[model samples]
Target: MSLSIRNQIAGTVTDVATGGAMGSVKVSVEGGELTAAITKDAVEALGLASGTSVVALIKSTEISLAAA
Candidate 1:
Protein backbone atom coordinates (compact mmCIF):
# COMPACT_ATOMS: atom_id res chain seq x y z
CA MET A 1 0.00 0.00 0.00
CA SER A 2 1.05 3.51 -0.75
CA LEU A 3 1.29 5.99 2.14
CA SER A 4 0.26 9.60 2.01
CA ILE A 5 3.09 11.54 3.55
CA ARG A 6 4.70 14.78 2.65
CA ASN A 7 8.34 14.23 3.41
CA GLN A 8 9.50 17.77 3.21
CA ILE A 9 11.48 18.37 6.34
CA ALA A 10 15.21 18.66 6.84
CA GLY A 11 16.96 18.06 10.14
CA THR A 12 20.38 18.15 11.72
CA VAL A 13 22.17 15.54 13.69
CA THR A 14 22.20 16.47 17.36
CA ASP A 15 23.48 13.22 18.84
CA VAL A 16 24.55 9.73 17.89
CA ALA A 17 24.87 6.47 19.78
CA THR A 18 26.96 3.67 18.35
CA GLY A 19 27.94 1.57 21.33
CA GLY A 20 25.60 -1.24 20.39
CA ALA A 21 25.37 -3.49 17.35
CA MET A 22 23.25 -0.91 15.63
CA GLY A 23 23.88 2.81 15.66
CA SER A 24 21.16 5.16 16.83
CA VAL A 25 21.04 8.73 15.58
CA LYS A 26 19.08 11.62 17.00
CA VAL A 27 17.97 14.53 14.89
CA SER A 28 16.21 17.76 15.67
CA VAL A 29 13.78 19.22 13.19
CA GLU A 30 10.88 21.62 13.18
CA GLY A 31 11.20 22.17 16.92
CA GLY A 32 11.04 18.46 17.50
CA GLU A 33 13.44 15.62 18.20
CA LEU A 34 13.50 12.37 16.25
CA THR A 35 15.57 9.24 16.71
CA ALA A 36 16.25 6.60 14.11
CA ALA A 37 17.89 3.22 14.43
CA ILE A 38 20.50 3.06 11.73
CA THR A 39 23.22 0.64 10.95
CA LYS A 40 26.52 1.13 12.73
CA ASP A 41 28.36 0.73 9.45
CA ALA A 42 26.15 3.33 7.82
CA VAL A 43 26.73 5.77 10.65
CA GLU A 44 30.45 5.42 10.15
CA ALA A 45 29.97 5.54 6.42
CA LEU A 46 28.08 8.82 6.65
CA GLY A 47 30.55 10.22 9.15
CA LEU A 48 27.70 11.65 11.18
CA ALA A 49 28.52 14.15 13.90
CA SER A 50 26.87 16.52 16.31
CA GLY A 51 26.48 19.17 13.66
CA THR A 52 25.93 17.01 10.64
CA SER A 53 22.99 17.89 8.45
CA VAL A 54 20.37 15.21 7.85
CA VAL A 55 16.92 14.82 6.42
CA ALA A 56 14.05 13.43 8.47
CA LEU A 57 11.73 11.74 6.01
CA ILE A 58 8.43 11.95 7.81
CA LYS A 59 6.28 8.91 7.41
CA SER A 60 2.93 10.24 8.53
CA THR A 61 1.44 6.96 9.64
CA GLU A 62 4.61 6.17 11.47
CA ILE A 63 4.49 9.41 13.41
CA SER A 64 2.58 9.83 16.64
CA LEU A 65 1.73 13.22 18.08
CA ALA A 66 1.44 13.50 21.87
CA ALA A 67 1.48 16.07 24.58
CA ALA A 68 4.06 15.99 27.34
Candidate 2:
Protein backbone atom coordinates (compact mmCIF):
# COMPACT_ATOMS: atom_id res chain seq x y z
CA MET A 1 0.00 0.00 0.00
CA SER A 2 1.03 3.56 -0.63
CA LEU A 3 1.19 6.17 2.11
CA SER A 4 1.73 9.91 2.08
CA ILE A 5 3.41 9.86 5.48
CA ARG A 6 7.17 9.91 5.04
CA ASN A 7 8.20 9.21 8.63
CA GLN A 8 8.02 5.46 8.68
CA ILE A 9 9.83 3.25 11.12
CA ALA A 10 10.12 -0.52 11.11
CA GLY A 11 9.82 -2.20 14.44
CA THR A 12 8.69 -5.29 16.30
CA VAL A 13 5.52 -5.43 18.34
CA THR A 14 6.52 -5.62 21.97
CA ASP A 15 3.11 -5.40 23.62
CA VAL A 16 -0.60 -4.89 22.99
CA ALA A 17 -3.00 -3.60 25.59
CA THR A 18 -6.68 -3.47 24.86
CA GLY A 19 -9.42 -2.05 27.00
CA GLY A 20 -12.81 -0.58 26.39
CA ALA A 21 -12.90 0.37 22.71
CA MET A 22 -9.27 1.31 22.33
CA GLY A 23 -5.97 -0.48 22.10
CA SER A 24 -2.37 0.51 22.60
CA VAL A 25 0.41 -1.12 20.64
CA LYS A 26 4.03 -0.87 21.66
CA VAL A 27 6.70 -1.30 19.03
CA SER A 28 10.38 -1.66 19.77
CA VAL A 29 12.54 0.46 17.51
CA GLU A 30 16.28 1.00 17.30
CA GLY A 31 16.90 2.83 20.55
CA GLY A 32 13.50 2.92 22.14
CA GLU A 33 9.87 1.95 21.76
CA LEU A 34 7.00 3.72 20.07
CA THR A 35 3.44 3.39 21.27
CA ALA A 36 0.35 3.93 19.16
CA ALA A 37 -3.21 4.15 20.35
CA ILE A 38 -5.77 2.75 17.94
CA THR A 39 -9.14 1.15 17.86
CA LYS A 40 -9.53 -2.34 19.15
CA ASP A 41 -11.20 -3.37 15.93
CA ALA A 42 -8.24 -2.11 13.95
CA VAL A 43 -5.97 -4.09 16.18
CA GLU A 44 -7.98 -7.24 15.51
CA ALA A 45 -8.11 -6.52 11.80
CA LEU A 46 -4.35 -6.19 11.63
CA GLY A 47 -3.91 -9.26 13.85
CA LEU A 48 -1.42 -7.37 15.98
CA ALA A 49 0.35 -9.37 18.64
CA SER A 50 3.62 -9.59 20.44
CA GLY A 51 6.53 -10.25 18.07
CA THR A 52 4.57 -9.04 15.06
CA SER A 53 6.50 -6.87 12.66
CA VAL A 54 4.98 -3.56 11.69
CA VAL A 55 5.82 -0.25 10.11
CA ALA A 56 4.83 2.84 12.04
CA LEU A 57 3.89 5.78 9.85
CA ILE A 58 3.96 9.08 11.64
CA LYS A 59 2.24 12.12 10.20
CA SER A 60 2.30 15.15 12.39
CA THR A 61 2.58 18.87 12.05
CA GLU A 62 4.71 19.41 15.11
CA ILE A 63 7.41 17.38 16.83
CA SER A 64 9.60 18.17 19.82
CA LEU A 65 13.11 16.90 20.38
CA ALA A 66 15.04 16.86 23.62
CA ALA A 67 18.27 15.40 24.85
CA ALA A 68 18.13 12.83 27.60
**Lowest lDDT 10-mer window, candidate 1?**
1-10
Cα TM-score of candidate 1: 0.70
Q: List lDDT for all candidates, in order.
A: 0.84, 0.93
Per-residue accuracy of model 1 over 13-41 as CA lDDT, tens digit each:
99999975788999998879889888899
Model 2, range 1-68, lDDT digits (tens) per residue? Answer: 88878788999999999998999999999999999999999999999999999998888554567898
**Backbone N/Cα/C clashes per model:** 0, 0
TM-score leader: 2
**Model 2 steric clash pairs:** none
What is the Å distance of residue 26 in model 1 from its true position? 0.8
Give Cα distance to truth, residue 18, candidate 2, Å. Answer: 0.4
**Clash list (residue pairs), candidate 1:** none
